[model samples]
Target chain A: MKELSLNILDIAQNSITAEADLVEITLNETETELELSIKDNGYGMSPEFLASVHDPFSTTRTTRKVGLGIPLLKLAAEQTGGHIELTSVQRSVDPENCGTEIKAFFRKDHLDFTPIGDIVSTVTTLIQGFPEVDYVFTHRICEAGSEKLVALDTREMRIILGDDVPLSDPMVLMWVRQTLEEQYAG
Target chain B: MKSLEELAKIRERMQNKVILREGQASTRVAVGMATCGIAAGARPVLNAFVEEVAKQNLSDKVTVSQTGCIGMCRFEPIVEVFEGDNERVTYVKVTPEMAKEIVEKHLKGGKPIAEYTIGAAEK
Candidate 1:
């Protein structure tokens, strides 16, 4: 992917497809490194399926023969002198502790590091697309000895909006965009 | 820091208005958003539709959502518009600019842009 945000969107969709109610995307960035982690309390994968996820041919979709989401992310991370780790516990195996977590570490100073572009839009798009699902997005930046954190939790929004107003409501989405933008600005 | 208090105000304001039930919109816009679609730049197209739908104030009548791969990887960034029960139009290789036009000409004006449809691309 040209942008890390696109990769995030792609990987996050896998969690959505797995019927996850809560997905957490966290970005922990320092001066020289960035760690992107997406964790989901979804169906997760069997050990067999998790083993094949690195292969381009391993896919759950019936539409085509290729699944590039994970592979592409792995490549992107490797290109930046970084690596990725994927761990999952199948729901059938452990119904209580079943989920998947994918963590990618990228070297920010590497020549091939893809920029994290327009993440605010990526997040808003996810909420708009899957309003029923709860998302917790936290971007923590540690640079020049000062740390900043930007975060949003849909569960909190749901508490405020109740069952009547959906998170997908245009007004709510607009507020989300504005709120995130304000956080990034300050 | 931005707070949830603002969201509370929005909810209070929207509580009086009628909320549309899911799948109740007369017009539905579905954007392909699988791995292929995202790799092909569907995010911007999807966002464009969301923005245009809200910008045109058609949120009441029109709903925009995402779909997985339709086995049309080559013609990705595909967008499909559905009207009523059976009428479906698929547009291929859509850009954000074209998404705006789609909302205006098709969703609002009730005319599918023939030139942008999959049928046109096949020719």
Candidate 2:
């Protein structure tokens, strides 16, 4: 992926495929470092599968022999003098706490650090594609002794929308885009 | 800044309209969004289709959704258009510009662009 946001989108797809009901994407940016964490309440992978997740050739997909999402993300972080961590608890192993979390750290000062682009687009696209699921997105940046935060939680919107209005409604999506843009602007 | 109050108003307005359209759409546009597809720039292509479908007021007839890899990484950024139960057209190596044409010419006009289909790409 050219942009870190694209990687975020790709990784989130894995959660969707695993049938996650709730997905949380958080970004913390400091003067010298950036961290991205994606957590999903889905049917997490088995230990054997998790062990091979870093290998591009090991994939849950039967269609192709390679899955590049995790590996590409690992490379992107490592290239920026950072690292990635992944943890999962399969539904079979722990039904009460079955999910996956991926955390990637990047050095902001590193020359190879990829830019986080169009995150607003990513959040909206995820909602539009899967209206049944809920998502929480938060981005925090701390610089020069100041901090700015932008956050959105779809669960609150759902309560107001009730079961009648879908989150994917075009009007709602337009509002979401505008709201996030305004937050980023401030 | 936009607030939740605005969303509440929208919800009130959409509630009645949504109840009437609670059925499957006639056409489905599936964009490949797997890792390979993203690496080859599928995001823009998917966004284009979504925007065009909404702009054309075809949202009720056509639903755009994302799909995993169809084992066609070589043909990254692919799109599949399914009409009803029988017809499905697979377009390979799609770009955002091509997405617009597909939406306008193929989707709205009821004629698939022959040149962009997998058959044409193979030939």
| Chain B fold agreement for model 2, TM-score | 0.94
| Chain B structural similarity as TM-score, candidate 1 | 0.94
lDDT for each of the candidates? 0.92, 0.91
List the DockQ of the predictions in order. Answer: 0.80, 0.77
> How much lDDT does candidate 1 score?
0.92
Q: lDDT by residue for model 2 over A69-92, one digit each (tens)?
A: 999999999999999999999988
Find the candidate with the highest DockQ and give its number: 1
**Candidate 2 global lDDT:** 0.91
lDDT of 2 at B34: 85
Best model number under lDDT: 1
Error of 2 at A53 (Å): 1.2
- The candidate that wins on TM-score is 1
For model 1, the superposed segments whose C-alpha errors exceed 4 Å read: B19-24
Evaluate fnat for each of the predicted models and list the values in order.
Answer: 0.80, 0.78
